[model samples]
Target: ARPRVGYFYTGKTGSEIITEKLMKYKVETFQSMPIVVKEDDSAYDAISAMFLSDVGTLFAVDQDNNLVGVVSRKDLLRASIGNQGLQDIPVHIIMTRMPNVAVCYPDELLVEAANRLIDKQIDSLPVIERSNETGAKVVGRITKTTITKAFVELARNELM
Candidate 1:
Protein backbone atom coordinates (compact mmCIF):
# COMPACT_ATOMS: atom_id res chain seq x y z
CA ALA A 1 0.00 0.00 0.00
CA ARG A 2 1.23 3.50 -0.83
CA PRO A 3 1.85 5.89 2.03
CA ARG A 4 -0.95 8.37 2.58
CA VAL A 5 0.01 12.00 1.88
CA GLY A 6 -2.12 14.86 3.10
CA TYR A 7 -2.85 17.70 0.70
CA PHE A 8 -4.49 20.97 1.64
CA TYR A 9 -8.21 20.65 1.14
CA THR A 10 -9.25 23.30 -1.36
CA GLY A 11 -12.66 23.61 -2.98
CA LYS A 12 -11.08 22.98 -6.41
CA THR A 13 -11.06 19.51 -8.00
CA GLY A 14 -8.03 17.24 -7.67
CA SER A 15 -6.90 17.79 -11.24
CA GLU A 16 -7.15 21.54 -10.83
CA ILE A 17 -5.00 21.40 -7.72
CA ILE A 18 -2.48 19.17 -9.46
CA THR A 19 -2.22 21.56 -12.40
CA GLU A 20 -1.82 24.52 -10.08
CA LYS A 21 0.97 22.74 -8.24
CA LEU A 22 2.83 22.15 -11.48
CA MET A 23 3.11 25.88 -12.04
CA LYS A 24 5.98 25.88 -9.54
CA TYR A 25 7.79 23.23 -11.50
CA LYS A 26 11.55 22.81 -11.96
CA VAL A 27 13.80 25.24 -13.86
CA GLU A 28 14.52 22.69 -16.60
CA THR A 29 10.87 22.85 -17.60
CA PHE A 30 11.08 26.50 -18.67
CA GLN A 31 14.74 27.45 -19.19
CA SER A 32 15.61 28.97 -22.58
CA MET A 33 18.74 28.62 -24.69
CA PRO A 34 21.56 30.94 -23.66
CA ILE A 35 23.04 33.65 -25.84
CA VAL A 36 26.77 33.08 -25.59
CA VAL A 37 29.92 35.02 -26.41
CA LYS A 38 33.56 34.15 -26.13
CA GLU A 39 35.66 35.93 -23.49
CA ASP A 40 38.07 37.22 -26.14
CA ASP A 41 35.22 38.57 -28.28
CA SER A 42 34.86 42.31 -28.71
CA ALA A 43 32.44 44.32 -26.58
CA TYR A 44 30.79 45.56 -29.74
CA ASP A 45 30.13 42.03 -30.91
CA ALA A 46 28.61 41.05 -27.59
CA ILE A 47 26.38 44.11 -27.56
CA SER A 48 25.27 43.43 -31.09
CA ALA A 49 24.34 39.89 -30.16
CA MET A 50 22.40 41.22 -27.19
CA PHE A 51 20.45 43.55 -29.44
CA LEU A 52 19.79 40.83 -31.97
CA SER A 53 18.84 38.28 -29.34
CA ASP A 54 16.74 40.80 -27.37
CA VAL A 55 18.34 39.82 -24.10
CA GLY A 56 19.94 41.85 -21.32
CA THR A 57 22.69 39.41 -20.48
CA LEU A 58 25.18 37.18 -22.27
CA PHE A 59 27.20 34.27 -21.00
CA ALA A 60 30.93 34.40 -21.73
CA VAL A 61 32.29 31.03 -22.70
CA ASP A 62 35.73 29.57 -23.30
CA GLN A 63 36.76 28.15 -26.67
CA ASP A 64 35.24 24.84 -25.63
CA ASN A 65 31.95 26.57 -24.72
CA ASN A 66 32.49 26.21 -21.00
CA LEU A 67 31.07 29.07 -18.98
CA VAL A 68 33.81 31.51 -17.98
CA GLY A 69 31.97 34.68 -17.11
CA VAL A 70 28.82 36.77 -17.41
CA VAL A 71 28.35 40.17 -19.03
CA SER A 72 25.40 42.53 -18.79
CA ARG A 73 24.14 45.44 -20.87
CA LYS A 74 25.23 47.79 -18.12
CA ASP A 75 28.78 46.51 -18.46
CA LEU A 76 28.83 47.24 -22.17
CA LEU A 77 27.24 50.64 -21.65
CA ARG A 78 29.89 51.55 -19.13
CA ALA A 79 32.61 50.50 -21.50
CA SER A 80 31.14 52.48 -24.39
CA ILE A 81 30.40 55.64 -22.38
CA GLY A 82 34.03 55.99 -21.29
CA ASN A 83 35.17 57.12 -24.76
CA GLN A 84 36.85 53.78 -25.28
CA GLY A 85 36.53 51.91 -28.57
CA LEU A 86 34.06 49.07 -28.09
CA GLN A 87 35.38 47.10 -31.05
CA ASP A 88 38.80 46.83 -29.47
CA ILE A 89 37.81 46.20 -25.86
CA PRO A 90 37.43 42.52 -24.99
CA VAL A 91 34.30 41.32 -23.19
CA HIS A 92 36.35 39.55 -20.53
CA ILE A 93 37.51 42.94 -19.19
CA ILE A 94 33.99 43.81 -18.03
CA MET A 95 32.50 40.40 -17.43
CA THR A 96 31.77 39.03 -13.98
CA ARG A 97 34.45 36.39 -14.05
CA MET A 98 33.93 32.76 -13.20
CA PRO A 99 34.04 31.76 -9.51
CA ASN A 100 32.25 35.08 -8.97
CA VAL A 101 29.20 34.52 -11.18
CA ALA A 102 26.08 33.12 -9.62
CA VAL A 103 24.70 30.05 -11.36
CA CYS A 104 21.87 27.56 -11.08
CA TYR A 105 21.78 23.86 -11.77
CA PRO A 106 19.36 22.45 -14.36
CA ASP A 107 17.63 20.16 -11.88
CA GLU A 108 16.84 22.80 -9.24
CA LEU A 109 13.37 24.20 -8.60
CA LEU A 110 12.39 27.24 -10.69
CA VAL A 111 11.12 29.10 -7.66
CA GLU A 112 14.48 28.59 -5.97
CA ALA A 113 16.25 29.96 -9.00
CA ALA A 114 13.90 32.94 -9.02
CA ASN A 115 14.69 33.57 -5.39
CA ARG A 116 18.41 33.49 -6.15
CA LEU A 117 17.99 35.98 -8.97
CA ILE A 118 16.13 38.32 -6.68
CA ASP A 119 18.50 37.87 -3.79
CA LYS A 120 21.54 38.35 -5.98
CA GLN A 121 19.92 41.41 -7.56
CA ILE A 122 20.67 40.18 -11.06
CA ASP A 123 18.58 39.79 -14.18
CA SER A 124 19.40 36.15 -14.95
CA LEU A 125 21.20 32.99 -13.96
CA PRO A 126 23.12 30.66 -16.23
CA VAL A 127 21.84 27.13 -15.83
CA ILE A 128 24.93 24.97 -15.58
CA GLU A 129 25.98 21.33 -15.38
CA ARG A 130 29.03 19.70 -13.83
CA SER A 131 31.67 18.61 -16.34
CA ASN A 132 34.55 16.23 -15.79
CA GLU A 133 36.97 18.59 -17.48
CA THR A 134 35.48 22.04 -17.10
CA GLY A 135 34.28 23.15 -13.70
CA ALA A 136 30.87 24.05 -15.07
CA LYS A 137 29.19 24.19 -18.46
CA VAL A 138 26.40 26.60 -19.23
CA VAL A 139 23.48 24.67 -20.67
CA GLY A 140 20.68 27.23 -20.58
CA ARG A 141 19.55 30.54 -19.13
CA ILE A 142 16.66 31.50 -16.87
CA THR A 143 15.60 35.10 -16.94
CA LYS A 144 12.85 37.32 -15.55
CA THR A 145 11.12 37.14 -18.92
CA THR A 146 11.15 33.36 -18.83
CA ILE A 147 9.57 33.32 -15.37
CA THR A 148 6.92 35.86 -16.35
CA LYS A 149 6.05 33.93 -19.49
CA ALA A 150 5.74 30.71 -17.54
CA PHE A 151 3.47 32.41 -15.04
CA VAL A 152 1.30 33.85 -17.79
CA GLU A 153 1.02 30.45 -19.42
CA LEU A 154 -0.01 28.82 -16.18
CA ALA A 155 -2.59 31.52 -15.51
CA ARG A 156 -4.05 31.08 -18.96
CA ASN A 157 -4.15 27.33 -18.53
CA GLU A 158 -5.87 27.70 -15.18
CA LEU A 159 -8.48 29.97 -16.70
CA MET A 160 -9.24 27.57 -19.52
Candidate 2:
Protein backbone atom coordinates (compact mmCIF):
# COMPACT_ATOMS: atom_id res chain seq x y z
CA ALA A 1 0.00 0.00 0.00
CA ARG A 2 1.30 3.50 -0.83
CA PRO A 3 1.43 6.03 1.94
CA ARG A 4 -0.97 8.90 1.47
CA VAL A 5 0.52 12.36 1.49
CA GLY A 6 0.05 15.66 -0.25
CA TYR A 7 3.07 16.45 -2.37
CA PHE A 8 3.40 19.29 -4.85
CA TYR A 9 5.03 17.29 -7.59
CA THR A 10 6.72 19.59 -10.08
CA GLY A 11 7.02 18.36 -13.63
CA LYS A 12 10.53 18.11 -15.03
CA THR A 13 11.93 19.99 -18.06
CA GLY A 14 9.11 22.19 -19.27
CA SER A 15 9.70 25.63 -20.80
CA GLU A 16 6.28 26.70 -19.62
CA ILE A 17 7.46 26.90 -15.98
CA ILE A 18 8.99 30.31 -16.65
CA THR A 19 12.27 31.63 -15.30
CA GLU A 20 11.43 31.56 -11.61
CA LYS A 21 10.49 27.89 -11.45
CA LEU A 22 13.60 26.89 -13.32
CA MET A 23 15.91 28.82 -11.00
CA LYS A 24 15.68 26.41 -8.06
CA TYR A 25 16.64 23.47 -10.22
CA LYS A 26 19.33 25.27 -12.23
CA VAL A 27 22.14 23.13 -10.88
CA GLU A 28 25.54 22.54 -12.40
CA THR A 29 25.85 19.74 -14.90
CA PHE A 30 28.81 17.98 -16.41
CA GLN A 31 30.45 20.34 -18.92
CA SER A 32 33.51 22.48 -19.61
CA MET A 33 36.99 21.04 -19.78
CA PRO A 34 39.00 22.29 -16.85
CA ILE A 35 42.00 24.52 -17.51
CA VAL A 36 45.05 22.66 -16.30
CA VAL A 37 48.77 22.96 -15.77
CA LYS A 38 51.31 20.24 -15.24
CA GLU A 39 53.14 19.77 -11.96
CA ASP A 40 56.45 20.41 -13.72
CA ASP A 41 55.29 23.32 -15.89
CA SER A 42 57.05 26.68 -15.62
CA ALA A 43 55.07 28.60 -13.01
CA TYR A 44 55.57 32.03 -14.55
CA ASP A 45 54.26 31.15 -17.97
CA ALA A 46 51.47 28.91 -16.74
CA ILE A 47 50.24 31.35 -14.13
CA SER A 48 50.25 34.21 -16.60
CA ALA A 49 48.19 32.29 -19.09
CA MET A 50 45.82 30.98 -16.43
CA PHE A 51 45.20 34.46 -15.07
CA LEU A 52 44.43 35.66 -18.55
CA SER A 53 42.09 32.70 -18.96
CA ASP A 54 39.98 34.28 -16.19
CA VAL A 55 39.67 31.24 -13.98
CA GLY A 56 39.92 31.62 -10.26
CA THR A 57 42.51 28.85 -9.97
CA LEU A 58 44.43 26.50 -12.18
CA PHE A 59 44.03 22.74 -11.86
CA ALA A 60 47.43 21.13 -11.53
CA VAL A 61 47.89 17.88 -13.39
CA ASP A 62 50.30 15.00 -13.18
CA GLN A 63 51.84 13.25 -16.21
CA ASP A 64 48.39 11.86 -16.81
CA ASN A 65 45.38 14.20 -16.92
CA ASN A 66 44.60 13.41 -13.27
CA LEU A 67 44.02 16.40 -11.07
CA VAL A 68 46.76 16.68 -8.44
CA GLY A 69 46.55 20.16 -7.00
CA VAL A 70 45.13 23.66 -7.31
CA VAL A 71 46.99 26.96 -7.50
CA SER A 72 44.95 30.03 -6.71
CA ARG A 73 45.38 33.42 -8.36
CA LYS A 74 46.49 35.05 -5.12
CA ASP A 75 49.08 32.37 -4.47
CA LEU A 76 50.54 32.71 -7.93
CA LEU A 77 50.59 36.48 -7.79
CA ARG A 78 52.23 36.54 -4.38
CA ALA A 79 54.85 34.04 -5.48
CA SER A 80 55.55 36.02 -8.62
CA ILE A 81 56.01 39.30 -6.72
CA GLY A 82 58.17 37.69 -4.07
CA ASN A 83 60.65 35.64 -6.07
CA GLN A 84 61.95 36.12 -9.56
CA GLY A 85 62.77 32.40 -9.57
CA LEU A 86 59.07 31.68 -9.24
CA GLN A 87 58.82 31.94 -12.99
CA ASP A 88 61.05 28.92 -13.43
CA ILE A 89 59.55 27.05 -10.49
CA PRO A 90 57.01 24.28 -10.84
CA VAL A 91 53.37 24.84 -9.79
CA HIS A 92 53.76 22.11 -7.14
CA ILE A 93 55.60 24.62 -4.99
CA ILE A 94 52.48 26.75 -4.63
CA MET A 95 49.61 24.34 -5.19
CA THR A 96 47.12 23.09 -2.66
CA ARG A 97 47.51 19.34 -2.46
CA MET A 98 44.91 16.77 -3.51
CA PRO A 99 44.15 15.96 0.11
CA ASN A 100 43.03 19.52 0.68
CA VAL A 101 40.98 19.80 -2.47
CA ALA A 102 37.26 20.42 -2.01
CA VAL A 103 35.61 18.49 -4.82
CA CYS A 104 32.10 17.26 -5.58
CA TYR A 105 30.61 14.67 -7.84
CA PRO A 106 28.49 15.66 -10.87
CA ASP A 107 25.41 13.92 -9.42
CA GLU A 108 25.48 15.78 -6.13
CA LEU A 109 22.40 17.84 -5.27
CA LEU A 110 22.64 21.55 -5.81
CA VAL A 111 21.45 22.39 -2.30
CA GLU A 112 23.90 20.02 -0.68
CA ALA A 113 26.72 21.11 -2.97
CA ALA A 114 25.97 24.74 -2.30
CA ASN A 115 26.16 24.09 1.43
CA ARG A 116 29.55 22.49 0.96
CA LEU A 117 30.70 25.57 -0.96
CA ILE A 118 29.57 27.83 1.84
CA ASP A 119 31.27 25.67 4.45
CA LYS A 120 34.50 25.60 2.45
CA GLN A 121 34.30 29.27 1.50
CA ILE A 122 35.50 28.59 -2.00
CA ASP A 123 34.47 30.39 -5.18
CA SER A 124 34.02 27.18 -7.14
CA LEU A 125 34.31 23.41 -7.01
CA PRO A 126 35.70 21.02 -9.57
CA VAL A 127 33.08 18.38 -10.32
CA ILE A 128 34.79 15.01 -10.47
CA GLU A 129 34.12 11.31 -10.53
CA ARG A 130 36.42 8.32 -10.18
CA SER A 131 37.44 6.83 -13.49
CA ASN A 132 38.20 3.11 -14.05
CA GLU A 133 41.18 2.38 -11.79
CA THR A 134 42.77 5.77 -12.13
CA GLY A 135 42.37 8.97 -10.13
CA ALA A 136 39.36 11.29 -10.18
CA LYS A 137 38.74 13.07 -13.46
CA VAL A 138 37.20 16.52 -13.54
CA VAL A 139 34.02 16.64 -15.59
CA GLY A 140 32.62 20.07 -14.80
CA ARG A 141 32.87 23.19 -12.65
CA ILE A 142 30.30 24.64 -10.22
CA THR A 143 30.52 28.24 -9.17
CA LYS A 144 28.32 30.37 -6.94
CA THR A 145 27.02 31.82 -10.18
CA THR A 146 25.34 28.51 -10.95
CA ILE A 147 22.90 28.70 -8.08
CA THR A 148 22.41 32.46 -8.09
CA LYS A 149 21.43 32.54 -11.73
CA ALA A 150 19.00 29.70 -11.09
CA PHE A 151 17.30 31.48 -8.22
CA VAL A 152 17.20 34.75 -10.12
CA GLU A 153 15.42 33.16 -13.04
CA LEU A 154 12.88 31.52 -10.76
CA ALA A 155 12.23 34.80 -9.00
CA ARG A 156 11.71 36.55 -12.28
CA ASN A 157 9.03 34.08 -13.31
CA GLU A 158 7.31 34.14 -9.94
CA LEU A 159 7.15 37.94 -10.06
CA MET A 160 5.85 37.98 -13.61
Candidate 3:
Protein backbone atom coordinates (compact mmCIF):
# COMPACT_ATOMS: atom_id res chain seq x y z
CA ALA A 1 0.00 0.00 0.00
CA ARG A 2 1.27 3.56 -0.82
CA PRO A 3 1.60 6.16 1.92
CA ARG A 4 -0.11 9.55 2.06
CA VAL A 5 1.93 12.70 1.20
CA GLY A 6 -0.19 15.85 1.45
CA TYR A 7 -2.13 15.34 4.68
CA PHE A 8 0.22 17.35 6.96
CA TYR A 9 -0.81 20.78 5.79
CA THR A 10 -4.05 22.01 7.35
CA GLY A 11 -3.92 25.82 7.59
CA LYS A 12 -0.30 26.68 8.26
CA THR A 13 1.00 30.08 7.19
CA GLY A 14 4.32 30.45 5.37
CA SER A 15 5.84 32.20 8.36
CA GLU A 16 4.65 29.40 10.62
CA ILE A 17 6.22 26.76 8.44
CA ILE A 18 9.55 28.61 8.30
CA THR A 19 9.56 29.21 12.03
CA GLU A 20 8.83 25.57 12.77
CA LYS A 21 11.65 24.49 10.49
CA LEU A 22 14.11 26.91 12.09
CA MET A 23 13.15 25.92 15.62
CA LYS A 24 13.79 22.27 14.86
CA TYR A 25 17.16 22.95 13.25
CA LYS A 26 20.34 22.91 15.33
CA VAL A 27 23.26 25.30 14.77
CA GLU A 28 25.79 22.51 14.79
CA THR A 29 24.09 20.95 11.81
CA PHE A 30 25.09 23.91 9.64
CA GLN A 31 28.22 25.33 11.24
CA SER A 32 31.44 25.35 9.27
CA MET A 33 35.15 25.26 10.08
CA PRO A 34 36.34 28.29 12.05
CA ILE A 35 39.42 30.20 11.07
CA VAL A 36 41.44 30.82 14.20
CA VAL A 37 44.29 33.17 14.99
CA LYS A 38 46.50 33.59 18.00
CA GLU A 39 45.80 36.63 20.15
CA ASP A 40 49.41 37.80 19.86
CA ASP A 41 49.53 37.44 16.13
CA SER A 42 50.07 40.58 14.08
CA ALA A 43 47.02 42.24 12.60
CA TYR A 44 48.46 41.65 9.14
CA ASP A 45 48.61 37.95 9.78
CA ALA A 46 45.07 37.94 11.05
CA ILE A 47 43.87 39.74 7.95
CA SER A 48 45.88 37.35 5.80
CA ALA A 49 44.24 34.41 7.50
CA MET A 50 40.81 35.90 6.89
CA PHE A 51 41.53 36.41 3.21
CA LEU A 52 43.09 32.97 2.81
CA SER A 53 40.17 31.28 4.51
CA ASP A 54 37.63 33.47 2.65
CA VAL A 55 35.95 34.29 5.93
CA GLY A 56 34.86 37.64 7.28
CA THR A 57 35.58 36.75 10.89
CA LEU A 58 38.34 35.05 12.79
CA PHE A 59 38.34 33.62 16.31
CA ALA A 60 41.36 34.38 18.41
CA VAL A 61 42.26 31.31 20.45
CA ASP A 62 44.65 30.80 23.27
CA GLN A 63 47.52 28.28 23.38
CA ASP A 64 45.03 25.68 24.52
CA ASN A 65 42.70 26.38 21.54
CA ASN A 66 40.14 28.08 23.80
CA LEU A 67 38.32 31.06 22.38
CA VAL A 68 39.64 34.38 23.65
CA GLY A 69 38.42 36.97 21.21
CA VAL A 70 36.75 37.62 17.84
CA VAL A 71 37.99 39.81 15.02
CA SER A 72 35.96 40.96 12.08
CA ARG A 73 36.93 42.30 8.69
CA LYS A 74 35.54 45.68 9.68
CA ASP A 75 37.74 45.70 12.73
CA LEU A 76 40.83 44.99 10.68
CA LEU A 77 39.97 47.52 7.99
CA ARG A 78 39.22 50.22 10.53
CA ALA A 79 42.52 49.63 12.26
CA SER A 80 44.48 49.47 9.05
CA ILE A 81 43.18 52.51 7.19
CA GLY A 82 44.17 55.01 9.86
CA ASN A 83 47.62 54.03 10.93
CA GLN A 84 50.91 53.54 9.15
CA GLY A 85 52.09 50.92 11.66
CA LEU A 86 48.79 49.08 11.93
CA GLN A 87 50.17 45.87 10.53
CA ASP A 88 52.54 45.52 13.49
CA ILE A 89 49.70 45.72 15.99
CA PRO A 90 48.44 42.49 17.54
CA VAL A 91 44.96 41.09 17.02
CA HIS A 92 44.22 41.20 20.75
CA ILE A 93 44.29 44.97 20.52
CA ILE A 94 41.46 45.09 18.01
CA MET A 95 39.49 41.97 18.78
CA THR A 96 36.27 41.86 20.74
CA ARG A 97 37.39 40.14 23.91
CA MET A 98 35.73 37.23 25.60
CA PRO A 99 32.80 37.95 27.89
CA ASN A 100 31.88 40.66 25.40
CA VAL A 101 31.48 38.29 22.47
CA ALA A 102 28.15 36.63 21.74
CA VAL A 103 28.56 32.87 21.41
CA CYS A 104 26.43 29.79 20.87
CA TYR A 105 26.91 26.23 21.94
CA PRO A 106 26.70 23.39 19.47
CA ASP A 107 23.53 22.00 21.03
CA GLU A 108 21.60 25.26 20.73
CA LEU A 109 19.01 25.95 18.06
CA LEU A 110 20.13 27.73 14.89
CA VAL A 111 17.29 30.19 15.21
CA GLU A 112 18.65 31.39 18.55
CA ALA A 113 22.05 31.92 17.01
CA ALA A 114 20.47 33.77 14.12
CA ASN A 115 18.67 36.02 16.60
CA ARG A 116 21.93 36.70 18.37
CA LEU A 117 23.58 37.69 15.11
CA ILE A 118 20.73 40.04 14.29
CA ASP A 119 20.34 41.49 17.78
CA LYS A 120 24.03 41.98 18.31
CA GLN A 121 24.61 43.32 14.78
CA ILE A 122 27.35 40.81 14.14
CA ASP A 123 28.12 38.50 11.28
CA SER A 124 29.18 35.32 13.04
CA LEU A 125 29.10 33.38 16.28
CA PRO A 126 31.85 31.18 17.57
CA VAL A 127 30.38 27.77 18.30
CA ILE A 128 31.77 26.75 21.65
CA GLU A 129 32.06 23.45 23.43
CA ARG A 130 32.74 23.34 27.17
CA SER A 131 35.75 21.32 28.13
CA ASN A 132 37.14 20.22 31.46
CA GLU A 133 40.65 21.29 30.58
CA THR A 134 40.25 24.10 28.07
CA GLY A 135 37.18 25.92 29.26
CA ALA A 136 35.27 27.00 26.13
CA LYS A 137 36.85 25.64 23.01
CA VAL A 138 35.71 26.93 19.65
CA VAL A 139 34.44 23.91 17.79
CA GLY A 140 33.04 25.67 14.74
CA ARG A 141 31.55 28.90 13.46
CA ILE A 142 28.09 29.87 12.26
CA THR A 143 27.72 32.96 10.13
CA LYS A 144 25.01 34.92 8.35
CA THR A 145 25.88 32.92 5.23
CA THR A 146 25.32 29.69 7.11
CA ILE A 147 21.95 30.84 8.35
CA THR A 148 20.90 31.93 4.88
CA LYS A 149 22.05 28.62 3.47
CA ALA A 150 19.97 26.76 6.03
CA PHE A 151 16.91 28.85 5.21
CA VAL A 152 17.37 28.20 1.51
CA GLU A 153 17.71 24.49 2.13
CA LEU A 154 14.57 24.49 4.26
CA ALA A 155 12.64 26.29 1.54
CA ARG A 156 13.86 23.83 -1.06
CA ASN A 157 12.86 20.89 1.11
CA GLU A 158 9.41 22.34 1.67
CA LEU A 159 8.92 22.90 -2.03
CA MET A 160 9.96 19.38 -2.89
- Give one digit per residue, the lDDT tens place, for model 2 in 72-130: 77778778887459767788888888979898776666666778779998767777875
Q: What is the C-alpha RMSD of each candidate to the true structure, in Å?
A: 5.4, 6.6, 4.8
Q: Point out the higher-scoring one by TM-score: 1 or 2.
A: 1
Off by over 4 Å in 1: 1-24, 158-160
Q: Which lDDT tens digits does candidate 1 get at residues 42-131?
A: 999999999999999999999888889999988999999987799999999999998999999888888788889899999999999855
Where model 3 places Cα greater than 4 Å from the true spot, the runs are 1-15, 131-134, 158-160
Candidate 3: residue pairs that collide: none
lDDT of 3 by residue, 1-160 (tens): 4446865545778898777766787877889998999999999999889889999999998888788999999999988886657668999999999999999989999889999999999999999985577467888999999988877877678522
TM values, all candidates: 0.82, 0.72, 0.86
CA-RMSD of model 3: 4.8
> Pairing residues by index, what is the TM-score of model 2?
0.72
Q: Positional deviation of 32 in candidate 1, in angstroms?
A: 0.3
- Please report how far candidate 1 places residue 10 from its true position, in Å: 7.7
lDDT scores in order: 0.88, 0.71, 0.88
Clashes of 3: 0
